[model samples]
Target: MHFFFHGQESLSILDWILRAAVIFIFVIFTVKIMGSRAISQLRLLDFVIALMLGNIIAHPLSDHRIGLKGSVISTIVIVVLYLLGIFLSLKWPGLRRIINSKPFPLIKDGEILYKGLKRARISIDDLLAELRKEKVEDVKKVALAIWESSGEISLFLEPQFEAITPSFYQLQTEPFDLPQTVIREGRIDFSVLRRIGKEEEWLIHTLRSSHHTEINNILLATIDRQHNLQVFLYK
Candidate 1:
């Protein structure tokens, strides 16, 4: 234990472990309070807060000279400021403009806007790569493309180039229903079965008669809204 915690200054193995656990729990609590968008959809404000929090929290974990108390207090203050900034951005239009940039047009009316591309700090080659990612072979097929503040390109295909759906033909279709999993990895999910109003005996009987397999043989099984039991067996 001494060897493991050597050169860590005065922090013993147990002390280091306790500090790590506390920091980990504290960070999780703060993240929950800040909301999922802080990590999932990182805008300018979110990015800055995330960067700052990571830097502040990391130093105390490694350096004994930096106390955990100071880091924790600093983190709480930063999180509060971040929340306040988000609230202010929502209430004040002027402040929002400063924090979040408006979507810049990269392509308009099937023509690439070179000026917009320059403003976005992307070259012609980069624009072509993004187009390729959207499965667009020709620039003329794009009706409009906007560079979002989150650094993602939003592409819209010309009406003529858009994929045809059943709605286009005015065709009738069944209502969409998500299949509920009853069995996974050869184990039956009784809670799911209960929720879907199905019995254990019925599932066993169905597997043996319909799928010609036993419960242990199934890798996955789902029941649809229409009482259709689909089973997949292990390979």
Candidate 2:
């Protein structure tokens, strides 16, 4: 007693499920080919594209009146647009700025940026929740808090409120020397030696004096202001 479109049966639940699976696979494959990142670090525009993916599927899956082919085409179009935006952003800094917003200072030197908070559309409770994630109980202890465009929060504490180190006890602290690895997995870093104003001959001589005739036997070696040629040999 019932009639069907094009003399074929209306799409069933199984048909809908299969169509959804195919679309999902297609979307994932397309994203992978584009070298897209995971959703967690997604920017606002990226999140919107993700939601568009769901939007394309939701209606067709629920309503038999909606065509699956139409949904698939629409989803592809949206994805292509997203990919284009990503490409253009890389080429043009202006476009990149539009896509990824500038980092807003939520806190500066223990002072809250109320205007920025409002612009970011986050409540004080939301800000506190983010701080709590960093294990910061008191806002006054924080020196800087940045609202990154990627929806990540960065916190910096004042030096006075920073972690207690051996230097805190007035121990003989070495001058600030960037800890550079001079050797890793038995490979020497000649560039690091040049930066530290040391010669390859000096390093070879030092290793020989320490009874390390072969650089390949060394697992790690570091040079800093406080020490010279710290070598860790393989067991």
Candidate 3:
């Protein structure tokens, strides 16, 4: 990481200036060409390529021996090879399949596939760890677990365990102000009433209008954006 040093004279002034431009372009090109797969997942090949590039580029910048031109050529060739891989992967589906690993199921229908985990090179503990990251404490809760090609675990929980989303009911939502609890557990939250610019008299009048004359009868009451005070009476 000679590119990250300070107060060192490993190379001449011109050498530093020239190599900086090359390094910048090299990094930009590699990252852009590799796509999010290289950044987020970082397959074994990508990791190796990145490490090689760092060493290859830094060596020439650090000493007068390895010469800047050779490093530049090495960087160019590496970038070219990567670009070629992308082009060929696009032209030929079979080659693309070879280059990129497909998602493999680690768990199917709540059963842990030991053989699948073995083929994926993932240990039982590692599989559990990835599950834990998704807040899955037990494999029994998982309906399916796929080891993604991007080196991440994709978890699918049983239908009963999945959270109910708005889409489930086909309900649409509109923006609304946060509801303020005006009463809780048969206690009048005067602070909330005051903040919402209402007094005890107003609360009593509103409750009476709804035939709920007594505040102690309210187990919970909240004021919504529409200034509607929805009250839940104590049983």
Single out the weakest 10-residue window by summed lDDT for candidate 3.
Answer: 31-40
Per-prediction tally of clashes: 0, 0, 0
Q: Which predicted model would earn the best TM-score?
A: 1
Clash pairs for candidate 2: none
Residue 17 in model 2: shift from native, Å? Answer: 25
lDDT of 3 by residue, 92-184 (tens): 999766656667899998899998887677689988988888988988989999877566778999999899988899999887588999989
Per-model TM values vs. the true structure: 0.79, 0.52, 0.56
Report clash pairs, candidate 3: none
lDDT for predicted candidate 1 compared with the true structure? 0.78
Best by lDDT: 1
RMSD of each: 9.0, 10.9, 11.9
Whole-structure CA lDDT of model 2: 0.74
Off by over 4 Å in 3: 1-40, 43-45, 175-235
Candidate 2 lDDT by residue in tens digits, 1-235: 1222133345555444445455444554454333222334676556666766778889889998777876676576667667776788889999787556678788998889998787566789988998899889999999999877766778999998889998788788766777779999999999998887888888888889876567888899988865377788999
